[model samples]
Target: MRVGIAGGGIAGLTLAWLLSESHEVVLLEERPRLGGNVKSVLTAADGGPCAIDLGVRETPVEVSPVWRHIAAAVGVSAGDLVATTASRVVLRKHERSPLWVSAADPTDTARPVTTGGPAYRAMARFADESARWETEGMSWDVTVGDVLDSWPLPSTAVRHLLCALPASLHGCTTDEVRSLSARAVGTTFTPPHTVPRTTYLRSGNSSLVHGLAAGARPARLLLGTGLRAVRRAGEGFELVDSAGAVHATDVVALALPADHALAALSGLAGAGAWRTALKAVEYREVTYVLHHDPYGMPENRRTWSAGNTTVDGNRSETTTWYGPSLGVDLFVSQLDHRAGRPREELARSSFRATLPTPQACRARQRLGAIHEGQRLLFLGHCTTPVETQEAAMASAVAVAQHLTPCGKRLRDYLEGG
Candidate 1:
């Protein structure tokens, strides 16, 4: 079988790797490089040059078994997986003090407010209730705003915990976070009973991308080209690329973003439902700025945390990732149109993130209907409930299993058989 995978992101790369052993695979990427949202850069630091990740940085091993398993399967050594700590703080506009901070070591002088009085208590309550909502299977239509409004917590507490925090995480405005489905938020932010350790690729995510591509060795690797359209060709399909070249494949898998996938299939016959479902998944633009200044941090240095979220009026909330993990002074901030660019900015990149609004969530559920029993398949963020690296790889695993029989070794590792 010959398979043509579009969009050389994690999803498309992983799919090509999984099928390469048994089939002739061709991978196409619009960008010169792969890895999709997994981007890393080298920056000059005090000690030496350090690698700073601008996108898809860390993963919690407890929640991301697929990512952990695949990293090892691709020959990424254990030493390259570095365990790290994650601490977050929330601050109000122009305030030197943090409105809330996560619990930290008691002896750490930099920790602000050992106890977060009302806000901490409210957070506990919210976590408990959100977990219960998940256990009971909350409806897809229930918005986070709906749940937060029903709570008796103070408005400030609700705003900081539910609105600002998620806004920064999802790269959206507080108002936009409110319309997100409660189930989607709950699944992504389910407060664990115990703290979980997070890990990042010490060599940066680009290493993983290189490893997958090297191992896959696809029949044809086309970079700097994109899928223009998909058309029926006898019992297979003909993929027209932006360079006016045609590639025929027995199967087609779209690993591109929902909007891009829809546009690629615009010329295909009998694809109205597929186009509609893909179009229903909306996206918001997020800009990432890498700099040496504390653009989005709280005014106080003692209250600085690994992740700092600043909430101000009408402007979209911004989150700054402190550089202590990289042992550098660099910082990465997520900014929207309303925010100003960092003063000491070294580099900037922009991405279109899918908004997990109630409407978008419902649309995602219908995507499977369009792809089932069809030669064309949709994977990655367009199909997954949560936007995580693990989910993206899992989507590839599903497609690989559907298309071919899994070998015992790979099957045992993925399924714990």
Candidate 2:
């Protein structure tokens, strides 16, 4: 079979790599480079050129079985993985004090603000409640606001965890966070009993991208060629490229975002259902700025953690990632439209992310039905919940399972075989 993959991100790359073993694969990317959101940058340092990931950074190994399997499969040595503790602090604008802080590291002299108080009790309660909520199998339509309203949490706790924290993580406004699915938000922010173990690629995420590309060995790797449109041929599909060229393939897997994928299928017949579902998946534009200045950190440097979020009214909450892994003062801040550009910005890039609203989550569920009995398929964030690399890769694995005989073998590989 001849497979055509659109959008050369992790999902597309993984699908191509899986299919290339038995089929001729052609991967198309609009950008000149691969690794769509897995962008890493090198900066001058005293020891050497330190790599900083401007896009996807850390992966929690416990929850990221597929990512771990892929990294190891691609020859990523154990030395390349650096284990790190994920910590966070939340601050309000113009306030010298922090609204909430995780337990301080042993090296820090400053004590945590919410060690024992209403905020502390609220945090503890939330953890327990969210865990129960998960086990209770809460409805998908339940909004974060609905959950928060039911809780007897203090305003500060609500601001810190449910509002600012999720807003910072998703690169959306606090108000926008209210409409998001409680199940999704709970899955992300629910505190575990112990500190979760996470890891970062010592050389950066691009190493995995390079490995996938090298292994995939697609017959035609078309970078800088966007998929303009898709039309049904007699038995297969015809993909129109940006340069006015049409490529025919036995199967088509669109690993692009919902909007991008929908736009390309404008010429396809019987695509109304696909278009409607795609439109329900709302997206927000997030800009990441890498810089030397602490644009979004708390006023006190001692309270700094791996992730620092600042909450301000009507503005999107900003999260700054302090580069403890790089052993440098480098910082990456996620900003929305409201937050102005950073002063000492070294580099800036923007990306579109799907908001996991109840509507959007429902839309994602319908994608499987839309692709039923059709050669056209959807993968990546469009087909999965939460925009993590692990989810993206898992979606690709599903597609590979559907199209090839090695699907069970691949699933076993992802399950740590």
- Using lDDT as the measure, the top candidate is 2
Per-residue lDDT value at 244 in model 2: 91
lDDT of 1: 0.76
lDDT of 2 at 339: 50
Put down candidate 2 lDDT per residue, 323-404, tens digits, no spaces.
6555677788886654566687787788777788998988887774444456889888887767788988888887887788
The list of candidate 2 runs beyond 4 A from truth reads: 104-110, 337-343, 369-373, 407-416
**Residue runs of model 1 more than 4 Å from their true location after superposition:** 105-110, 113-116, 190-196, 337-341, 369-373, 407-412, 415-417
Number of backbone collisions per candidate:
0, 0
TM-score of every candidate relative to the true structure: 0.92, 0.93
Native-referenced Cα lDDT, model 2: 0.78
**Against the correct fold, how does model 2 do in TM-score?**
0.93
- Per-residue CA lDDT of model 1 for 1-417, tens digit only, reads 889999898988888888887788888898998999989887777867776778887878667887878878788899987775666677777766677776333245566653646676666666777788778977778998898788777666446656776676677777788788877877655342233357777777888888888878745779999998898999999999999999999999999988888989998989897788888788777778889887777777776777777777634455556454555667888867544667877878887778888877777777643434567888888887678898899888878877775744357556761
